[model samples]
Target: MAVSVYRGFHLQSAPNSTEVWQVKIKNHVLTGNLAAIKKSIDWWCETASLIDPREFESLNAKREESTGALHEDFNGYTLKNDTGAPNAWYCFFNGRLIKGSKLAIQKHIEAYLVAKQRAEAKQAQQKK
Candidate 1:
Protein backbone atom coordinates (compact mmCIF):
# COMPACT_ATOMS: atom_id res chain seq x y z
CA MET A 1 0.00 0.00 0.00
CA ALA A 2 1.13 3.50 -0.79
CA VAL A 3 1.59 6.10 1.94
CA SER A 4 -1.17 8.25 0.47
CA VAL A 5 -3.82 5.62 1.30
CA TYR A 6 -3.73 6.00 5.08
CA ARG A 7 -5.65 8.57 7.20
CA GLY A 8 -6.18 9.20 10.90
CA PHE A 9 -6.84 11.83 13.57
CA HIS A 10 -5.07 15.18 13.57
CA LEU A 11 -6.71 17.16 16.34
CA GLN A 12 -9.01 15.95 19.10
CA SER A 13 -11.04 17.82 21.70
CA ALA A 14 -9.45 15.60 24.31
CA PRO A 15 -6.52 13.23 24.30
CA ASN A 16 -8.92 10.43 23.40
CA SER A 17 -11.71 12.44 21.87
CA THR A 18 -12.61 11.94 18.22
CA GLU A 19 -13.29 15.49 17.12
CA VAL A 20 -10.74 16.43 14.50
CA TRP A 21 -9.95 18.89 11.77
CA GLN A 22 -11.70 18.41 8.45
CA VAL A 23 -9.89 18.46 5.12
CA LYS A 24 -10.70 18.34 1.45
CA ILE A 25 -8.66 16.74 -1.26
CA LYS A 26 -9.88 16.93 -4.81
CA ASN A 27 -13.61 16.09 -4.70
CA HIS A 28 -13.53 14.11 -1.46
CA VAL A 29 -13.72 15.50 2.05
CA LEU A 30 -12.31 13.76 5.13
CA THR A 31 -12.16 14.60 8.80
CA GLY A 32 -9.12 13.71 10.89
CA ASN A 33 -5.60 15.05 11.34
CA LEU A 34 -6.07 17.68 8.69
CA ALA A 35 -2.70 19.42 8.86
CA ALA A 36 -0.67 16.22 8.97
CA ILE A 37 -2.55 14.66 6.10
CA LYS A 38 -2.16 17.77 4.05
CA LYS A 39 1.57 17.75 4.65
CA SER A 40 1.84 14.15 3.49
CA ILE A 41 -1.08 13.93 1.14
CA ASP A 42 -0.10 10.66 -0.48
CA TRP A 43 0.39 8.66 2.72
CA TRP A 44 -2.64 10.24 4.36
CA CYS A 45 -5.02 9.26 1.58
CA GLU A 46 -7.71 6.70 2.42
CA THR A 47 -6.86 3.49 0.62
CA ALA A 48 -9.20 0.87 2.03
CA SER A 49 -12.58 0.58 3.70
CA LEU A 50 -13.01 -1.37 6.91
CA ILE A 51 -15.88 -2.74 8.97
CA ASP A 52 -15.84 -2.51 12.74
CA PRO A 53 -13.34 -5.02 14.07
CA ARG A 54 -15.60 -6.36 16.81
CA GLU A 55 -18.62 -6.88 14.60
CA PHE A 56 -16.46 -8.75 12.16
CA GLU A 57 -15.19 -11.11 14.84
CA SER A 58 -18.69 -11.83 16.06
CA LEU A 59 -20.05 -12.46 12.60
CA ASN A 60 -17.19 -14.85 11.87
CA ALA A 61 -17.51 -16.68 15.24
CA LYS A 62 -13.89 -15.94 16.02
CA ARG A 63 -14.23 -14.88 19.60
CA GLU A 64 -11.12 -14.25 21.66
CA GLU A 65 -10.08 -16.62 24.40
CA SER A 66 -9.90 -13.92 27.07
CA THR A 67 -12.27 -11.01 26.88
CA GLY A 68 -13.55 -7.93 28.61
CA ALA A 69 -15.39 -6.41 25.68
CA LEU A 70 -16.41 -8.69 22.84
CA HIS A 71 -15.17 -6.32 20.20
CA GLU A 72 -12.64 -3.49 20.07
CA ASP A 73 -13.64 -0.38 18.21
CA PHE A 74 -10.44 1.36 17.18
CA ASN A 75 -12.37 4.52 16.46
CA GLY A 76 -13.55 5.06 20.02
CA TYR A 77 -11.71 8.34 20.09
CA THR A 78 -13.36 9.57 16.92
CA LEU A 79 -16.30 11.78 17.85
CA LYS A 80 -19.65 11.49 16.19
CA ASN A 81 -20.72 14.31 13.92
CA ASP A 82 -23.51 16.81 14.60
CA THR A 83 -25.94 14.30 13.11
CA GLY A 84 -24.55 11.66 15.47
CA ALA A 85 -22.61 10.21 12.59
CA PRO A 86 -19.19 8.70 12.63
CA ASN A 87 -17.84 10.64 9.72
CA ALA A 88 -15.43 9.07 7.23
CA TRP A 89 -12.66 10.19 4.88
CA TYR A 90 -11.78 9.66 1.25
CA CYS A 91 -9.17 7.50 -0.42
CA PHE A 92 -6.67 9.24 -2.64
CA PHE A 93 -6.61 6.41 -5.13
CA ASN A 94 -10.32 5.93 -5.82
CA GLY A 95 -11.78 8.99 -4.08
CA ARG A 96 -13.97 6.63 -2.04
CA LEU A 97 -14.86 7.80 1.43
CA ILE A 98 -14.20 5.45 4.38
CA LYS A 99 -13.99 5.32 8.14
CA GLY A 100 -10.87 7.25 9.08
CA SER A 101 -9.75 5.79 12.39
CA LYS A 102 -10.69 2.22 11.61
CA LEU A 103 -8.83 2.29 8.34
CA ALA A 104 -5.82 3.92 10.00
CA ILE A 105 -5.78 1.36 12.77
CA GLN A 106 -6.14 -1.45 10.27
CA LYS A 107 -3.16 -0.19 8.36
CA HIS A 108 -1.11 0.04 11.56
CA ILE A 109 -2.11 -3.46 12.58
CA GLU A 110 -1.01 -4.76 9.21
CA ALA A 111 2.34 -3.05 9.54
CA TYR A 112 2.83 -4.39 13.06
CA LEU A 113 1.97 -7.95 12.04
CA VAL A 114 4.37 -7.82 9.13
CA ALA A 115 7.12 -6.48 11.35
CA LYS A 116 6.52 -9.17 13.95
CA GLN A 117 6.63 -11.86 11.31
CA ARG A 118 9.89 -10.55 9.99
CA ALA A 119 11.41 -10.37 13.48
CA GLU A 120 10.33 -13.96 14.22
CA ALA A 121 11.85 -15.13 10.99
CA LYS A 122 15.09 -13.33 11.77
CA GLN A 123 15.29 -14.79 15.28
CA ALA A 124 14.65 -18.28 13.97
CA GLN A 125 17.41 -17.91 11.42
CA GLN A 126 19.84 -16.59 14.08
CA LYS A 127 19.17 -19.66 16.25
CA LYS A 128 19.92 -22.05 13.40
Candidate 2:
Protein backbone atom coordinates (compact mmCIF):
# COMPACT_ATOMS: atom_id res chain seq x y z
CA MET A 1 0.00 0.00 0.00
CA ALA A 2 1.27 3.42 -0.91
CA VAL A 3 -0.13 6.92 -0.66
CA SER A 4 1.03 9.68 -2.97
CA VAL A 5 -0.26 13.16 -3.71
CA TYR A 6 -0.02 15.13 -6.93
CA ARG A 7 -1.28 18.56 -7.90
CA GLY A 8 -3.49 18.74 -4.79
CA PHE A 9 -4.80 15.26 -5.55
CA HIS A 10 -4.32 12.49 -3.05
CA LEU A 11 -3.71 9.11 -4.66
CA GLN A 12 -3.69 6.06 -2.44
CA SER A 13 -2.88 2.63 -3.86
CA ALA A 14 -3.73 -0.40 -1.79
CA PRO A 15 -2.55 -3.63 -3.34
CA ASN A 16 -4.94 -5.85 -1.51
CA SER A 17 -7.01 -8.73 -2.84
CA THR A 18 -9.11 -6.19 -4.73
CA GLU A 19 -6.15 -3.98 -5.72
CA VAL A 20 -8.06 -0.76 -5.13
CA TRP A 21 -6.85 2.76 -5.73
CA GLN A 22 -8.56 5.87 -4.42
CA VAL A 23 -8.05 9.45 -5.52
CA LYS A 24 -9.19 12.66 -3.89
CA ILE A 25 -9.05 16.05 -5.54
CA LYS A 26 -10.42 18.67 -3.22
CA ASN A 27 -13.92 17.50 -2.31
CA HIS A 28 -14.18 15.20 -5.31
CA VAL A 29 -13.54 11.52 -4.57
CA LEU A 30 -12.87 8.69 -7.01
CA THR A 31 -12.28 5.00 -6.33
CA GLY A 32 -11.06 2.44 -8.77
CA ASN A 33 -8.30 0.01 -9.64
CA LEU A 34 -4.82 1.08 -10.80
CA ALA A 35 -5.70 1.38 -14.47
CA ALA A 36 -8.81 3.41 -13.79
CA ILE A 37 -7.00 5.81 -11.52
CA LYS A 38 -4.14 6.24 -14.00
CA LYS A 39 -6.58 7.14 -16.75
CA SER A 40 -8.38 9.66 -14.54
CA ILE A 41 -5.15 11.30 -13.44
CA ASP A 42 -3.93 11.55 -17.03
CA TRP A 43 -7.14 13.25 -18.05
CA TRP A 44 -6.89 15.72 -15.19
CA CYS A 45 -3.35 16.66 -16.18
CA GLU A 46 -4.23 17.45 -19.78
CA THR A 47 -6.46 20.29 -20.85
CA ALA A 48 -10.24 19.81 -20.97
CA SER A 49 -10.52 20.92 -24.58
CA LEU A 50 -9.16 18.63 -27.20
CA ILE A 51 -5.68 19.35 -28.50
CA ASP A 52 -2.71 17.62 -30.05
CA PRO A 53 -1.47 14.85 -27.80
CA ARG A 54 2.07 15.71 -28.87
CA GLU A 55 1.67 19.08 -27.21
CA PHE A 56 1.67 17.38 -23.81
CA GLU A 57 4.97 15.64 -24.52
CA SER A 58 7.97 16.84 -22.62
CA LEU A 59 10.82 18.77 -24.27
CA ASN A 60 13.23 15.95 -23.55
CA ALA A 61 12.61 14.00 -26.71
CA LYS A 62 15.86 12.09 -26.27
CA ARG A 63 14.37 10.01 -23.44
CA GLU A 64 10.89 8.74 -22.75
CA GLU A 65 10.11 8.71 -19.04
CA SER A 66 7.23 6.26 -19.10
CA THR A 67 9.43 3.52 -20.40
CA GLY A 68 11.67 3.87 -17.36
CA ALA A 69 14.49 3.19 -19.76
CA LEU A 70 16.54 6.10 -18.52
CA HIS A 71 16.97 8.56 -15.67
CA GLU A 72 18.07 12.19 -15.51
CA ASP A 73 20.35 14.02 -13.12
CA PHE A 74 19.58 17.31 -11.42
CA ASN A 75 21.95 19.03 -8.97
CA GLY A 76 23.93 15.82 -8.65
CA TYR A 77 20.75 13.96 -7.70
CA THR A 78 19.27 11.15 -9.72
CA LEU A 79 15.69 11.83 -10.88
CA LYS A 80 13.85 8.58 -11.33
CA ASN A 81 10.60 9.05 -13.15
CA ASP A 82 8.09 7.04 -11.21
CA THR A 83 5.23 7.83 -13.55
CA GLY A 84 5.05 9.84 -16.74
CA ALA A 85 1.45 10.65 -15.88
CA PRO A 86 1.22 13.52 -13.42
CA ASN A 87 4.98 13.81 -14.12
CA ALA A 88 5.84 12.14 -10.86
CA TRP A 89 9.57 12.01 -10.05
CA TYR A 90 11.67 10.74 -7.20
CA CYS A 91 14.79 12.87 -6.66
CA PHE A 92 17.27 11.45 -4.18
CA PHE A 93 19.51 13.89 -2.35
CA ASN A 94 21.40 11.99 0.30
CA GLY A 95 18.21 10.06 1.06
CA ARG A 96 16.17 13.27 0.93
CA LEU A 97 13.17 12.57 -1.20
CA ILE A 98 11.12 14.86 -3.48
CA LYS A 99 8.25 13.69 -5.62
CA GLY A 100 7.18 15.97 -8.42
CA SER A 101 7.92 17.10 -11.96
CA LYS A 102 11.44 18.02 -13.12
CA LEU A 103 10.71 21.69 -12.59
CA ALA A 104 9.52 21.08 -9.05
CA ILE A 105 12.72 19.22 -8.18
CA GLN A 106 14.79 21.89 -9.87
CA LYS A 107 13.20 24.57 -7.73
CA HIS A 108 13.77 22.49 -4.62
CA ILE A 109 17.44 21.93 -5.45
CA GLU A 110 17.92 25.60 -6.27
CA ALA A 111 16.47 26.59 -2.93
CA TYR A 112 18.67 24.09 -1.14
CA LEU A 113 21.80 25.35 -2.86
CA VAL A 114 20.95 28.96 -2.11
CA ALA A 115 20.46 28.16 1.56
CA LYS A 116 23.69 26.21 1.66
CA GLN A 117 25.62 29.06 0.09
CA ARG A 118 24.16 31.53 2.55
CA ALA A 119 25.05 29.35 5.49
CA GLU A 120 28.62 28.90 4.27
CA ALA A 121 29.01 32.66 3.76
CA LYS A 122 27.72 33.31 7.25
CA GLN A 123 30.14 30.80 8.70
CA ALA A 124 33.07 32.39 6.83
CA GLN A 125 32.09 35.89 8.04
CA GLN A 126 31.88 34.66 11.63
CA LYS A 127 35.40 33.27 11.40
CA LYS A 128 36.78 36.58 10.03
Candidate 3:
Protein backbone atom coordinates (compact mmCIF):
# COMPACT_ATOMS: atom_id res chain seq x y z
CA MET A 1 0.00 0.00 0.00
CA ALA A 2 1.85 3.02 -1.25
CA VAL A 3 0.77 6.37 0.13
CA SER A 4 1.68 10.02 -0.32
CA VAL A 5 0.52 13.57 0.45
CA TYR A 6 -0.26 16.22 -2.17
CA ARG A 7 -0.90 19.96 -1.79
CA GLY A 8 -2.06 22.62 -4.22
CA PHE A 9 -4.22 25.69 -4.63
CA HIS A 10 -7.47 26.00 -6.54
CA LEU A 11 -8.05 28.84 -8.93
CA GLN A 12 -11.10 29.72 -10.97
CA SER A 13 -10.51 31.23 -14.38
CA ALA A 14 -13.91 32.87 -14.36
CA PRO A 15 -17.09 33.02 -12.39
CA ASN A 16 -19.02 29.76 -12.63
CA SER A 17 -16.15 28.43 -14.64
CA THR A 18 -13.97 25.38 -14.08
CA GLU A 19 -11.22 25.68 -11.49
CA VAL A 20 -7.69 24.36 -11.75
CA TRP A 21 -4.38 24.42 -9.86
CA GLN A 22 -1.08 22.63 -9.69
CA VAL A 23 -0.10 20.35 -6.82
CA LYS A 24 2.83 21.68 -4.82
CA ILE A 25 3.81 18.55 -2.98
CA LYS A 26 5.36 15.75 -4.93
CA ASN A 27 3.55 12.44 -5.23
CA HIS A 28 5.03 9.55 -3.30
CA VAL A 29 4.26 5.86 -2.97
CA LEU A 30 5.19 4.10 0.22
CA THR A 31 5.30 0.43 0.98
CA GLY A 32 1.92 -1.28 0.99
CA ASN A 33 0.73 -0.57 4.50
CA LEU A 34 -2.30 1.13 5.98
CA ALA A 35 -0.21 2.71 8.74
CA ALA A 36 2.14 4.28 6.25
CA ILE A 37 -0.70 5.84 4.29
CA LYS A 38 -2.33 7.34 7.35
CA LYS A 39 0.95 8.81 8.48
CA SER A 40 1.34 10.45 5.11
CA ILE A 41 -2.03 12.18 5.35
CA ASP A 42 -1.24 13.49 8.82
CA TRP A 43 2.12 14.77 7.76
CA TRP A 44 0.66 16.41 4.69
CA CYS A 45 -1.98 18.19 6.71
CA GLU A 46 0.54 19.52 9.18
CA THR A 47 2.74 20.73 6.37
CA ALA A 48 -0.17 22.44 4.67
CA SER A 49 -0.92 24.33 7.86
CA LEU A 50 2.36 26.12 7.45
CA ILE A 51 1.00 27.81 4.34
CA ASP A 52 -0.33 31.32 4.73
CA PRO A 53 -3.83 31.21 6.16
CA ARG A 54 -4.97 33.91 3.78
CA GLU A 55 -4.31 31.76 0.76
CA PHE A 56 -6.26 28.89 2.22
CA GLU A 57 -9.08 31.17 3.27
CA SER A 58 -9.38 32.62 -0.19
CA LEU A 59 -9.57 29.21 -1.75
CA ASN A 60 -12.07 27.99 0.80
CA ALA A 61 -14.35 30.93 0.21
CA LYS A 62 -14.36 30.37 -3.54
CA ARG A 63 -14.94 26.68 -3.15
CA GLU A 64 -17.79 27.23 -0.73
CA GLU A 65 -19.56 29.56 -3.12
CA SER A 66 -18.96 27.28 -6.07
CA THR A 67 -20.07 24.19 -4.21
CA GLY A 68 -22.92 25.96 -2.37
CA ALA A 69 -21.75 25.28 1.16
CA LEU A 70 -18.97 25.92 3.58
CA HIS A 71 -16.57 23.11 4.28
CA GLU A 72 -14.49 22.14 7.25
CA ASP A 73 -11.15 23.84 7.66
CA PHE A 74 -8.36 22.51 5.49
CA ASN A 75 -7.39 19.58 7.68
CA GLY A 76 -5.51 18.10 4.75
CA TYR A 77 -8.14 15.50 3.91
CA THR A 78 -11.18 15.79 1.70
CA LEU A 79 -12.97 13.96 -1.07
CA LYS A 80 -11.33 15.39 -4.17
CA ASN A 81 -12.97 13.24 -6.81
CA ASP A 82 -15.66 10.66 -6.65
CA THR A 83 -18.02 9.16 -9.18
CA GLY A 84 -20.99 7.10 -8.08
CA ALA A 85 -20.44 4.76 -11.00
CA PRO A 86 -17.03 3.70 -9.81
CA ASN A 87 -15.86 3.43 -6.21
CA ALA A 88 -13.05 5.91 -5.59
CA TRP A 89 -11.66 8.20 -2.91
CA TYR A 90 -9.87 11.52 -3.27
CA CYS A 91 -8.67 14.11 -0.82
CA PHE A 92 -8.55 17.86 -1.26
CA PHE A 93 -7.30 20.98 0.47
CA ASN A 94 -8.16 24.63 -0.15
CA GLY A 95 -10.15 23.51 -3.22
CA ARG A 96 -7.11 21.83 -4.72
CA LEU A 97 -7.44 18.18 -5.71
CA ILE A 98 -5.09 15.88 -3.88
CA LYS A 99 -5.18 12.81 -6.08
CA GLY A 100 -4.87 9.38 -4.49
CA SER A 101 -6.51 6.01 -4.55
CA LYS A 102 -8.64 4.74 -1.68
CA LEU A 103 -5.82 2.56 -0.52
CA ALA A 104 -3.40 5.45 -0.64
CA ILE A 105 -5.69 7.63 1.41
CA GLN A 106 -6.15 4.89 3.93
CA LYS A 107 -2.41 4.52 4.25
CA HIS A 108 -2.00 8.25 4.73
CA ILE A 109 -4.47 8.19 7.59
CA GLU A 110 -2.68 5.25 9.14
CA ALA A 111 0.58 7.15 9.04
CA TYR A 112 -0.99 9.96 11.04
CA LEU A 113 -2.26 7.54 13.64
CA VAL A 114 1.15 6.00 13.93
CA ALA A 115 2.77 9.38 14.42
CA LYS A 116 0.24 10.20 17.09
CA GLN A 117 1.02 6.98 18.88
CA ARG A 118 4.69 7.74 18.82
CA ALA A 119 4.10 11.18 20.27
CA GLU A 120 2.01 9.70 23.03
CA ALA A 121 4.70 7.18 23.76
CA LYS A 122 7.28 9.91 24.00
CA GLN A 123 5.10 11.90 26.33
CA ALA A 124 4.58 8.88 28.53
CA GLN A 125 8.29 8.31 28.72
CA GLN A 126 8.86 11.92 29.75
CA LYS A 127 6.18 11.67 32.47
CA LYS A 128 8.12 8.83 34.11
Local accuracy of candidate 3 as per-residue lDDT tens digits, 1-115: 1222433322212233233222233443222122323334445677743333234546556655555322222235544433321225556533555555555665766677678
Deviation in Å, model 2, residue 14 alpha carbon: 32
lDDT (tens digit, per residue) of candidate 2 on 17-122: 3567777654566676655565566776775433222333332343454455337877787878744545677777757787777788888888989999999999
Give the top-scoring candidate (TM-score).
Answer: 2
TM-score of each: 0.26, 0.45, 0.30
> How are the candidates ranked when ordered by TM-score, highest leading?
2, 3, 1
lDDT of 2 at 39: 58
Worst 10 residues of 3 by lDDT: 9-18
* Reference-based TM-score, model 3: 0.30
Better of 1 and 2 by lDDT: 2
Off by over 4 Å in 1: 1-84, 87-100
Clashes of each: 11, 0, 13
| Tens-digit lDDT string for candidate 1 (40-100) | 3444344543223234335334323322222243322222222222323222222333345
* Alpha-carbon RMSD, candidate 3: 21.4
Consecutive 10-residue window with the lowest summed lDDT within model 2: 50-59
Better of 1 and 2 by TM-score: 2
The lDDT ranking, best first, is 2, 3, 1
lDDT of each: 0.41, 0.66, 0.44
